[model samples]
Target: MGIKAALSKPFAAYVHQRNQAWMQQPAQTQQKVFTSLIQKGASTAFGRDHKFKNIQNHADFTQAVPVRDYEGLKPYFERVKKGERDILWPGKPIYFAKTSGTTSGTKYIPISADSISNHINGARDALLAYVYQTGNSTFLDGKLIFLSGSPELDEVSGIKTGRLSGIANHHVPGYLRRNQLPSYQINCLDDWEEKLDAIIGETLHQPMTLISGIPPWVQMYFDRITAKTGKKIKDVFPDFNLFVYGGVNFEPYRAKLFESIGKPIDSIELFPASEGFFAYQNEQDDPGLLLLLNAGIFYEFIPVSEYYNENPRRLRIEEVEVGVNYALVISNNAGLWAYSIGDTVKFTSTRPYKVVVSGRIKHFISAFGEHVIGEEVEKAMHQTMQKFPEVEVVEFTVAPYVSPSAGQSYHEWLVAFAQPPQDLPAFRLELDQQLRQLNVYYDDLITGNILSPLKLTPLPSDAFQKYMKTQGKLGGQNKVPRLSNDRAIADALVKFKVES
Candidate 1:
């Protein structure tokens, strides 16, 4: 191992040991975070509005501050954007992470000085945890590339504002700066294709050991690398050992990624967003990400079944049960109080508080009361593909097809295939069967004749990519939603469909 890897071993061990202290007592750690958040919030304008002084405990907190999405908190956010002090947070945010909102046009999530460490530390420890567990810090010796958004920032009331990834670019640790690849100028390029080509040109001959990005974007980089070098990614970057990814589930893209690399590699999955860095995969063999309880964030979970209820019971860390889908609520030092980030997660392990991102709360199919989530669809796709080894999926999305020329209403799956299955009908049957097994509501609808079995639409290659390009969301944390309740996306996909 090189000097950097050699030095990281001892520090990695120390960090791992420190992390275990809080991971073992998750509820206690969370309670401490809750107390700290409440104390800090008491000094903000939101605290006065919500009667934070009267709040004593978690139950009191629920009563004082209702769970809200971005729109619900926009009034205070607007004040902060207008340079108001102590509006939502204790003071004006250091930066506003501008994100695309579904209902609200655009969201500006605040990143306070106190909460920035949580974002930076979570990412750092994820790597250190891997180094501690596997004694594999060799990647530190070579180029570590993060395929992220532009580092450029515009000012909003004198505070810097940009994409969360772009804001994070300014915080890359000093030690790793030497190993970080793709010149800053290339990262600042607005067009993804241009930035990608620039990234390839810069790193094509470098000793790239770690490449981090959303899986699809990374796949594009891999594709470009292979096209340029006329060799597998493994041959071009012989030392590349770690593939760090977030934003989407890696299973669907796993096969294609490994195929391009010509071998399997270890990966670290992160559960990060504009709001905060929530979790990171610690163990190489574990699929569950270790939730960061001691971070400056207090977490709550409302069961998905009860999320829409007038008074949904918000469960604290100790109350969460394994395998139950819960809408993740957070109150952090960043001043987002009892805020619903819209993501749902399943607790896989409670001992160390490990969770897997189940789906987005809004990104579900409940058109006919048969609610299906992202996790269920991804699993069904994964299982069906396992049986049909030749089938290679590029991307896919499901939307309700309520009206059909013939027969009952059915869910329509639009799939872009890298290698289309030989027997499309058989493949569709298996895929439908797997989904039915995973989701009982879907199964019941099919059996009750209320809905027909799902129909598969084999889309032209690059259909999803083309759609994303058209929407100006081609890369950098932009992903196609796995489930849609309406036909908007499906109707748009029709033009890209392959005719039988």
Candidate 2:
């Protein structure tokens, strides 16, 4: 083995040891750690400036500080935008990670040195868990490919400000950073076209082991790579062992990814956001386990049912019950206090604090997993529609449909079109292909003949927008509900008979 490979194994072992210790800690100890961190973070950021001299528990924290979304943080960001120092955190932040919200134009999320350190450490912990689970530390030896967001710093007000993805690339450990493929396949940095060319040029004969990125973007890269090289991905990265992806669901794209790379389900899904790296798939086979980062932030769980209720009970990490779905609330050092992340999850076990992502409380379809959510479904649709140029979707909604005859259930899609495809039947075929490629569950469901075929209905031009308007939820802060569990919403959509 080479020097770097030899060094990485021992480092991997060290990480595994640290991860084990943290995971083995009792729930009470974890809560204590979380509590101590929150008090420290609150004192450090808002203690002197804001009036929070009376707050105590997690409930007190949430009540003292109203739940703020990305837009709520804008005033603090304005100071940073003006090049002021120590606007949110104690020190001048090194850079900003630009991300988008459903309504907010673009969020320039600050990344302090401490925040960066937290992310790197969390990533290391995740990597070590992978090593322990897989029994393959050599997976770290090969060149790692990140199907990352555009790395180009956007030119704002004649000043170059790094986008979130680019800033993340910059902050990666220097050792691993050196082994990264050239800026080409890196996706969307400033010079996108040139970067694509560089990625194509460099990975011509390299031994890549790990591939990481959002699912849709990764598939896009694979398509581009296939077109350029005239070889399937398997031929290019024969030794690739692990695929680490975040910012979306891997279920939809699982089949396509594995088929393209000719690998098993050796993939890891990370639950990270522009705000912080929340959780990661500790075991490749398991969906993902929430490893509460007690050091960086304090976490709270509000029962999913309480989202609409005014008096929702907030549970600390220690108080959360297994098998129950809850919305995650976080208070991180970045100055977001008791912020609702909008995603929902359920605890599978409380000992090691393992959890499964139930769904986004704000984003859900039917009870079945068929209700695709943000990153996963978008990637699937993009992949499926790539074959058809004439078809363009302005908006879409998915709902559960149970066949009247056989009582078989499946997901039915309602798409509002910008333009209709010439061949509707062919479009359906393409959509099926895309869904199969995006998620193995759907593929397996189809192959097993357990679920009925996905049904697609085309809607009128202004149907989605009009519906949102009728609900008094048009434009800013309101998004077209992508997935809905409520049968009432589906019934309303069909009852209107609003075109396709």
Candidate 3:
């Protein structure tokens, strides 16, 4: 009935119809998208190096370009940072997303003109798809809150450089900017704690209908609001209905979030990264987001099973099969050619090429050759919470303890709890047992006495948050690593250990 809803209805219909067609011939859509990108950037340095002119087919393209990671692409990025035009894209990138993970200390990822469109339009389509499907369009009539990074962009050789949140913040259209909560002045406060305080002060009494943020920061906001007003989140924002979150798995945080809301609401899972907006959940019931075939990003999959092989197979969209774990690779309009984005995924629907995030290639516990992954660890936690409904995980990270400390080397878990299990030892045992079920290599490691049983360490009350804060990674897309290759992060958490 609202003006925004009335207008968006047709737009949503258009998107749904187009998506249906795209799904019918996923390979053809992908071919057209990628061919266009190749032609567009043929004169650029990367394209020339890879002989894109001769790449008439996927086979030729594969032979021409070797896969690369951030470090492998660093040389080109260095030239880009110096304002070189046609070094990657035809012209200079409009901005760069500055980020760091446990693996890469710092990365300045380019965002081309086409890449900006992909991100902004992809986000709009994802939201509209949900609105159209659920027949609930009133959320846009009221205020929308996005817990995001500082919008203050610093110039790098005349190109904007900042967090991806800041990059996104800069692109909100004027009309939507009017409905967005927390004035621009407050949204660009720079410091996470300071920005949260400003956000609380500005919008606590406003009529907010939608909120989007990573789960950890959103949890922090919910807790603070509950403490401040003595009301559940649903009561505080009576019209709140839509919650959009990504960046980390939402399973562990689901129970706690709903408990804070005091009601069920529709949620959307997104699969985006510093490189590109890869996929979005179009259906309410379907857990997998459609691997967008026409998003100006070419898709490739390296089976994690063969990722370490001397001659690992790189499978394209048509070549991928359902139920296989793959390290996702993308060559996008952003000029990142044959780049490995690091996150792993599994195909849930091959017809439309839909996928669910499986884990990360670098994020695992393989210190004892067990090779336990994020998916396994997450499932273990999910089961742990299931068996003991009284306990809820606030945040947790696991690292392989390969040291002979006290003559026992095992998996070390650093956990902070909102409400802990009644029997902590039983909870630890169940988690370890679940991992044994999830992975045979891990079970073999235990059976062969190569590694001891998992170790459980109860972190101080707010240790995860405190540790993240200390690392300057407390909000807006920064996440604590769930699994570390070494005790570097675990040792840091030990310092914040709650002496039980």
Candidate with maximal lDDT: 1
2 against 3, candidate with superior lDDT? 3
How displaced is residue 378 in candidate 3, in Å?
Answer: 0.3
lDDT of each: 0.92, 0.65, 0.88
Q: Of the candidates numbered 2 and 3, which has the greater TM-score value?
A: 3
Cα displacement (Å) at residue 121, model 2:
1.9
Lowest lDDT sum, 10 consecutive residues, model 2, at 472-481
lDDT of 2: 0.65
Instruction: Please give, for residues 1-500, the per-residue lDDT of candidate 3 as tens digits.
Output: 67886788888988899888988998898899889988987999988887888888877877888888999888999999998899888999999999885566789999998889888887888998997898888888889999988778999999999999878887887768889977889877768888898899888989899999999899999988999999999999999999998888899899998999999999999887889998889889999987788889999899998987876788879999898999998999889988999899999998777899988898998887788899999999999899999987788999977776543789999888888889999999999999999999999988888778899898755788888888888777888888998888999999988777
Report the alpha-carbon TM-score of model 3 versus the true structure. Answer: 0.98
- Expressed as tens digits, the lDDT of each residue in 56-81 for candidate 2 is 66556666676666677677677767
lDDT pick, better of 1 and 2: 1
lDDT of 1 at 489: 89
Candidate 1: which stretches are off by over 4 Å? 404-407
